[model samples]
Target: MSYRRTTDFLLHDWLEVSSLQSRARFADHNRETFDAVLDMCEKLAAEKFAPFNRLADTEEPWFDGEKVHLPAASHAAAKAYAESGMLAAAQDYELGGMQLPCVVEMAANSFFSKAGIGIGGGGMLTSGNANLLMAHGTPLQQQVFAANEFGGRFSGTMCLSEPQAGSSLSDVVTRAVPDGADFEAEPLGPRYRLRGNKMWISNGEHELTENIIHLVLAKIPGPDGKLVPGTRGISLFIVPKKLVGTDGQLTGERNDVALAGLNHKLGYRGIPNTLLNFGEGKFPVRGSAGAIGYLVGKSGEGLRCMFHMMNEARIAVGLGATMLGYAGYEASLAYAKDRPQGRPMGPSGKDATLPQIPIIRHADVKRMLLAQKSYCEGALALELYCARLVDEAHTGAPDDAAQAALLLEMLTPIAKSWPSEWCLEANSLAIQVHGGYGYTRDFPVEQYWRDNRLNMIHEGTHGIQALDLLGRKVVMDGGKGLQLLASRINATIERALALPDFAEQGNTLAATLAQVGAATKAAWATGNPEEALANATPYLQAFGHLVLGWIWLDVALCAQARAATLDHALLQGKLAACRFFFRHELPRVGAWLQVVTRRDDTCRTMDEAWF
Candidate 1:
């Protein structure tokens, strides 16, 4: 088995994750269940998904004017994924789900992502869409739209971005007007005529599923028939590709949701990214002028409702980036071990018969491998940590749940952005490890790099996440979330101090935490919010490193406690990675924090005309 697929570190880290879930009332999720789910995912990913990863990239989906055509393997893999009952892994059992913990679902998801992100993206998007409906949709809405999605009979999408609006929801111009008595009303809600264009809609016009349920964000005109400004007036609607009757059966009447065109991507080519004309005259719905849709939550609460999926998608994006890095690392490691090339630097005489050693023996090659290991493994840990926190937020005691929510709020941006930035670096290192061959399609590292590159910009751009981290998350509600995070880190520090093997690691992390706190204070002390946030990106990087450092120390302590019983190499690897991160990666936080705390505005203050 590839090291990426069956890393002991995954089971090691999952120990803590499972423990947290058990304490939060998830009693059925022991190691047996977790490992079973993981094993299933691993097998399915390798057999059904990984074989077609390269194929999917090479044979990108095509639009033949009307329909998007993808490889048969894409649909097959998606059906297998949905049939595994993982689509609703965390949903309630009564809702036709497995009721698995979110962390376990995340771990299982990593395998699919490692196999192929383009294929995994369909499952992730469907899961996110279903989760959102479960969270905020009415019972009828959940039964009609989300249930079929969970059952694999249908697929779902979140449609937010527009050509003009992009990430700025305030500028969205999609309008949803009440359809009146013309359209049939169901138990879900009143129907509306949705007329707008949704750009970058994944799974927008695919034949893989029977129906496509789009969670679209649009604004309803007020009493004056004028749309409200900004996200305040935006509303979420359930727009189906095919009209469904109140009985959840197809009406054979196609909705006015027409396919505008296909947007081919550099990577993630298996899933069709599209521009959808929701209510153009191309397809009329019952002689109606616009697409038929049902409002989701309140009229003006669209952003809030969409946020459920957005946040989930952000974390999923982070996981996608992490898995891509892991895939590259595994591929490079295998190549390094098997491919014989250079001899030792000192002993390589000009003898024509000298035996060439494997590249893994080289110090520089080891350095690159270690870098990838630390980055991919650390990112995986960070994402799982966030997933466990999500479980805590949802299922823990009152105060614990509140604190967990606060801490998750503070860490979400870091969890999303940090892995994206570092894991891409890991993929680069993997490419470097393979040298020339890595750049070519003969190996998978280059494709891994390409696929991961999209993650940095999707969900929310790194810059957007950084602004949220430094400008909003850390400072909101008088920094209660930040304080809660500090308290949790301090608790870990205290626990680590009691263990002799981890005292130094804990102390180093403690010092870094203190530096982060001080830097945050100094940055905000300027009282000029704009100036303080000028170098928010650097602050985000520094803060993200601090969070990773804390998580590493926490994991190290846990590993140390289990060292006697666990595999020796696994334990040593965790400790060594922790040390490597602290010695090499953590110190960079100091320099970044300096730029942050000093309120460096050289870049921000630069005149645009100068460029």
Candidate 2:
């Protein structure tokens, strides 16, 4: 019942998603089934997920030549999860899951991820692949392959990055050729016999489950030789770790994918990061390959199909970042209240005689805690907002879904990167709160730092996200993304202005957004699209704040609405967090705006000649 109050405040005041009292509440679009799923998620997260977090971090998974090792605690926890029939939470119930709404899955993920990311990562990847195959795979493909994953009998991966092609998919040299015998003039589908190397694949060598399903991307040679351009000529294949019979059961022929090496990463060690070799032998129908691969979609459409998985993964990365940061903040808050350390700076004999006060009593400690709370909570809100948008895009009636898609696309990079950046700040503050102990493995904050650091790199490095935001999303469909986002933010400001205690912040946000709009317009006209887009990261960040500020304000409105009916402090806590974010975080925009407008030559000036 100790950390219970804070957790309760987070769920109830900010994200209950069930309450209908607030006009600004997200519940209108949320269905009853969604609420039930969300409640279940929070229940298990607090009960089952959070408990084994430290153990997973302590007992990171390992690997031998044959199988990657995992902790027993993870097995128990995953079993609990699997038994709950929640593995395919986002899938159709017909696919063997509870069919939870995406937003709720994200919220529940907040708990599970906060508890343990390493183990949670496996579940997420499996879910993503199940979703991907359901969307693109044939009926037989779904029955044979994705079914086991959705059923929790297997796990899946999106294998795109090789040691050679980390971010640039165009540079992929992993080759695919025909595999089946009596091949026609040209065989279509995921069965072209894939061969190539895939590196940094999560769950690559794990024995956590019996089978590993890899949605692999590779290049196949044209009759003339040489490579193709763009994302064309790249294809995705459902390449199993071992070849299987067409009858949906396992066979013993090793496909091309083999782990060449495993990376001892700075974080997220529970899932093995692997380098895989593919297509080594001659196929019955066609050419020699170091490993076997079966194509996913038509040839030259691998990146497109992979995009489906990447988009989801991007959101997952954001959620992971949010959860880790939130957990660290929660831990710090607990320590601040319970770990009594110091007296007032100017203390009398009476003060000195007093028992050491909780660190929360100190001004500096409050500052740290407030900062941590703001980022962690705001990041979670941003992530949840995106999740809700996804829900809207799918479930909401007509007009709403279009708006949701636009706003969601605009915020994706910010959603992916801001949490990565700010959550790291939260973890840093957590360490500071723990003093020297945080630096040691004795406390999990240090591990939190290590784990959180990878997020900034993994899904798309912050820089890549920035470039995407600026270069593409901003320009995409002639600035529809930014304009759509502006429309929603404007609407939020308008609504909040009509409410009390929020009018001032609403005006402040409105003005800040206007400034952002001005900057965005200026960048749009800046002649150099690349240069303008170079500033996309900062633009994305500014846009994220506006969006998050809107969310916080909405939460404040919800809090006020609930205050009249519920008489609970949850709403009050939400208001306080909202006020803190607006006051403390929003004003920093002046500096970033200056960068976006003034065009700092820092990165541009760092020349090869200077080195």
Candidate 3:
């Protein structure tokens, strides 16, 4: 199915996102306006982004001593996206935003993600950066920094990872010191001088926009002049590439931030990823060595503020992974229908005179195609459902909003990690469907696979997400989040039980849910972190399958409701994918949960010396 058709079904038919018009935040939008937005984005993505997906991949960004050079197509795509007014799609009207529902905005952006994520630029990071400042920065900071970022004159990057500290935030050694005795009097906020090196920073250095807004994390020294240890001392800083005046105009002087080098990557090469040096005396301001930065929020709350962007990025990453898988699935499906292969055996035992049939006619080929459909479509539904929850958390009535937030917290890790794992598998199957042709770069499926492989490690690694799900998200708030999630799942189960066609799948899902709950209890039975998290990955896998099962079943109910009016083939296709997932995919949850329930430590305790 086309991206537009899929999104239309999810937004209007399944989620009924148009109902959001009743909310104050989206009061101005109706189905027409929403369709207009999606149509514009779809056209622009096809025109500017799709044609250059391969160009962006083949002609990777290169540095030329003073600046980085990307394909002109990449630059054009970025400019078009900026002009599309989607960066602030969810912001208020006064802020030059459409004030559309979050679900609608997410659906619109899916077009660009599927077209070419690399060429799509850093709009996600820039929007997330502006969103963070709007939430945490002073009013002046918002006007000067966030406003310009939303306007597309400034791009953004979140500088978190360092060469030594990777994902371990507590080990970060970047330091920020007071700029002067009167630093507190600075107009922007508390002024500081940051000196550190940030690694693997995407869009870290680019000329696509007038400036780059970097939200850097660094340590502030204590009274004794020694840096405080752990994340407790970490703080956020607004370190613009070019110093800006009170009027939000560039000061014409460079800040101390410098691009040390670019890290050549395997995929996503269209966007520059760099090692940045702050306050390294490379471009000293006011005859000083340190990079001037304005502090954001209070001290020691950097991670809290940064999580706002991180969580948003995680969901966006999941969407990107899903679209890439969808792209591959469509490609392989098209290929299967056109490529004639071996003929089916006849009762006569020989059919040399008969023409070869399309590969799609083969049972094994159908199995592979069905797997891809189940994974990609189910993941798409899951992401969109999460997006709908974002809308509810922001705009629903008080009690409902609170419940939405709790459910979102419980599902965020799964939303991010599950698609990253399974969609990449879908991409592999897509390539497999193409036979030998899929392995070559000539086909898009291979690149789709390469690009998707990065999602597993993008926002957070699979292991990190697993730990978050089992260690923190499930157990936090006296397990309220998990309980809220269970309630939502059981409600769907009850609905399915009322239908004879879905009653069996409902029972299977209930059993799986119970097994997951038991595993969760068994994992933490001893209250030991090491023991509980020993098989966290397996636990994550099982939990993710359970969530997908719930999502597919829920989606099937929607499709079934429209079966009388919807296109016969489309409705049947949806039902088939749902059945495929329950019969072929959901059973794997049992094996995964078995390992988790037993707190398997075979891999954890194995000595390196054993090798």
lDDT of 1 by residue, 118-237 (tens): 886888888889889888888888888888999888899989999998999899999998898744464667689999899998888888999999999999999999999877999999
In angstroms, give how far residue 440 of model 3 lies from its true place: 0.6
Colliding pairs, model 3: none
Better of 1 and 3 by TM-score: 3
What local lDDT does model 3 show for residue 144? 96
Error of 3 at 382 (Å): 0.9
Residue 109 error, candidate 2, Å: 2.4
Comparing 1 and 3 on lDDT, the stronger one: 3
Best by TM-score: 3
RMSD of each: 2.1, 3.7, 0.9
Greater TM-score among 1 and 2 belongs to 1
Which one is best on lDDT?
Answer: 3
RMSD of 2: 3.7
The candidates, ranked best first by TM-score, are: 3, 1, 2
Arranged by lDDT with the best first, the candidates are 3, 1, 2
Let me know the TM-score candidate 3 reaches against the reference structure. 0.99
